[model samples]
Target chain A: MLKRLAEVLRGMGHRIIDRIWRLGSGARFFLYTLIYSGESFRRIHLTIREIYFTGVMSLLIILVSAFFVGMVLALQGYNTLQKYGSSEAIGVLVALSLVRELGPVVTALLFAGRAGTAITAEIGLMKTTEQLSAMEMMAVSPIARVVAPRFWAGVVSMPLLAALFSMVGVLGGYLVAVPVIGVDNGAFWSQMQANVDFQADIVNGVIKSVVFGVACTMIALFEGFDAPPTAEGVSRATTRTVVNSSLAVLGLDFILTSFMIVT
Target chain B: MERTTMDLWVGIFAVAGAAALFGLALKVGNLTSSSVGDTYTVTAAFENIGGLKPRAPVKSAGVVVGRVDNIQFDSKTFEAKVTLKVDKRYPFPKDTFANIYTAGLLGEQYVGLEAGGDEQPLKDGDKISHTQDAVVLEKMISQFLYNKASESDDSKKAE
Candidate 1:
């Protein structure tokens, strides 16, 4: 019994130490990626191709989900606000909610599922197929060649996707509120315009999306880079990418919202 | 996909994204509406600020002419000092009365500038002497109740 307890304690300590070591390595990987990102700009076509793959391909899903989210926000907001006879304020509710919180967060979440998984899988497969090793053998850094463009593409795409989400979502809300629910069209647009300040609401949302972009893309790249060179390992790394990116986006959202709201 | 085709798609995506952001700024935000140009700062002191906040609109005759810049508390005089940034085109006189008014029932509070007929226009860092405190509901109710009580006491003494 004493020997078994000692072995359990030792195992727990090893796992904890391993986790800390991996975390440290992940940070180092992030720093290395940033340092090597110079090549991505120099070879602009690479980043553009990645943007075409990650951003352009992901636009359809982003717009569709955003529309639905906005419609739901309007329907729900109108139900509550009409009770107080302030249904005209529905535009403000939807716009503020989307621009401040939902646009960046939901876009980040969707981008993680749509583009992040693809990035992780592609990179992980390259590693599994020994392509990364071959490139390294041929004096080409995989971080610069494979990872940097994707990273920059993600960082660029995130804010645009978020902005598109907010804009489309507001239109969806307008559709539901004005035509379907008999709300005045003028009031809808005017209320939203009056209450949503450009600098405070729209600019802050862009900032949040940029931060989320960095976080989501970095996690995906790190997972792919760190995956064991095996089929099962690459698959597990893909799953971890989604899980880690989602959690990071949410946790960072709370922290970012706290910082944004105080100002 | 062909490189040129992919480039075209990316170009479209980029343009669409830019258009969406521009539309949001124009249609859903106060970017164009609240662009007061070349503002001059002025200050006013009030006994109570109520729910007045920074960036609240400063309207003259129901038209927004400026924005509230900052709010500070003066411990010496026990008044709230509010700084206003008014547009240069719509200048108020030195004797302009600054009154805190609510837009509508349950709406945000704003500063209303009722311009005084004076030849001298207010400049930056100038102070407005004529000011009205924001009406506190509780204070007004208490004052009304006190008046009623005093009136009944007088009636009883006369009887």
Candidate 2:
């Protein structure tokens, strides 16, 4: 029994050490990935291709989701503000909520599900099939040639995606509030214009999305690069990318909003 | 997708996104609307300002013509002094009545100018002497309750 206890303690200690080592390696990988991004400038076409895959492919879902969110916001806000005879402020409610919160968040979540998963699966496949090894044999840095362009692409595309989401959302809100809900056309717009500040709502939203883009892209690349060379590993990596990206987006949003609003 | 097609789509996406963003900034955010064109400044004083802030819209007959630039308190007169910046296109008469008006029942307060028929157009650095204070709902409710209580007490004594 004493010998068994010693073995179990030793196993636990080994597990802890392994976990710490993995974490340190992961940090090193992250630093190397960022450092190699400087080499991505000359390879703008590669970045564009990745942007097409990640951003363009994710656009439909983002637009649809944002539209519904805005519609719902306008509908619900109109109902609540109606009682107070201030239904005109529905524009304010919908626009502010979408620009500040829903636009970046929903876009990021959908991006994770669609583009992020694809990125992990593709990279994991490349690694699994020895494509990465082949590149390494040729003295081509995979981090610079493959990962950096994709990372920079994601970062570049995210703000544009978020902006499109918000603009489309505002349109959706307009449609529901102005025509369907019978909100005063002039009042709705005027109240919204009077209330929402460009610096406070729009700029802050862009900043939030930029931060989320970096975080989500980093998580995707990490999961892909860290996955073992197997089909099952790639599948698991894709799942992890989606899950981790979602959590990161939501968590980063909360922190960013706290800072943005307080300041 | 073909590389050229993808590139074209991306260019469109980026440009459209930028245009939409600019529109949002201009329309909803009201960035381009303020501090553009020509504007002149005038000052008004009131007994109570009531949650009014700088950058609040200054409306005339439901049309936004200017914005509140600043607010200061006068010690001797015991009044709130408000600086109004009016667009040059919208020149108000000398006898314009500036009143602090709330948009809705429980909405943001702004300065609503009731244009008076004076031949002379008000210029920069002019003082709007005729001003009205903001309505304090809490104070008004308390006064109303006090009035009702006193009325009930007087009626009881009479009986």
Candidate 3:
């Protein structure tokens, strides 16, 4: 019995040490990626190409989702506010909720599902196919030439996509509130304009999107780079990118929101 | 996509995004500074300031003319003292009534300036002698309940 207990204790200790080693190496990989990112600026064309893939391609999903989200917000908001005899405040409700919270959050989640998965899958495939090794053999750091552009692309795409989502959402709210619901258009818009502050709502949202962009992209690149050179590994990495990014976005949202409200 | 075509599309995307952001700021967020000119500060005193915070809108005739700059309680008077930042251009008369008003019935409290028919324009550091405090809903309810209880006691005695 003592022998068995000692064996179990040794296994647990080894597992803990292994986990720490993996975490340290992961941190090292992130720093290396950051150090080599300057090469991406020199290769501006590549970054732009990545942007087209990440931002422009993802625009459709972002737009559609935002529109639906906006309509729902207006519908739900009208139902609640109308009971208070203040249906006119629905515009404020829709705009504030979208611009301040939902727009950045939903856009990041969609970007993760769309562009983030593509990034992880593409990178993991490259690693699996020995393309990353081939580049290294040619004296090129794959982190600079490959990973950095994709990283920058995602970071740039997030805020732009979020902004577009908010603008489109406000439009959707208008469509439903004014035409379908037969609410006064002037009141819907004017109340929103009067209440929401540019610095407080819009700028802070942009900040949030940018932070989420960086975080999501980092997780995607890290998971992709670390995946094993196998089909199952690449698929797992893609799944991890989506799952991890969504959780990260939600977690960061709570922390950032508390800070934003205070400041 | 070709390099030039890619650049063009990216450019368009960026421009459109920026334009939308600008429009959001202007239309929905009121990002642009109010058309009001340089502003000056004034102060007001209230008995109770319910749910009023700094940067809350200060309005006149239903138009936002300024913002609440600061709020402090006077140790001597034990009343909430609020400082107002009013636009220099929209000068109010000396007799302008500075009153705490609630928006949307149960919404936030703001200072509403009702311009009194006085030709004399108020200046910086001047206090409007006329002021009204916020009406606390809880206090009103409690008072009503007290009155009802007293009336019931009076009826019991009569019986």
Q: What is the TM-score of chain B alone in each candidate?
A: 0.88, 0.84, 0.81
Report how far off residue B99 is in candidate 3 (Å). 1.8
Q: Rate the local accuracy (lDDT) of all candidates.
A: 0.92, 0.90, 0.90
Candidate 2 C-alpha lDDT tens digits along A133-202: 9999999999999999889888988988999999999999999999998988988888888789999999
Return the top candidate by DockQ.
2
Superposed model 2: Cα runs more than 4 Å off: A1-20, B74-78, B156-159
Q: What TM-score did chain B of candidate 2 earn?
A: 0.84
Model 3: TM-score, first chain:
0.95
Cα error of candidate 3 at position B54, Å: 3.1
Q: Which ten residues in a row have the lowest lDDT in candidate 1 chain A?
A: A186-195
Global Cα lDDT for candidate 3 = 0.90
Candidate 2 lDDT (Cα, 0 to 1): 0.90
Model 2 clash tally, residue pairs: 0
The TM-score each candidate achieves on chain A is: 0.97, 0.93, 0.95
The alpha-carbon lDDT assigned to residue A96 of candidate 1 equals 97
Candidate topping TM-score: 2
Query: What DockQ does candidate 3 have relative to the true complex?
Result: 0.56
lDDT of 1 at B25: 91
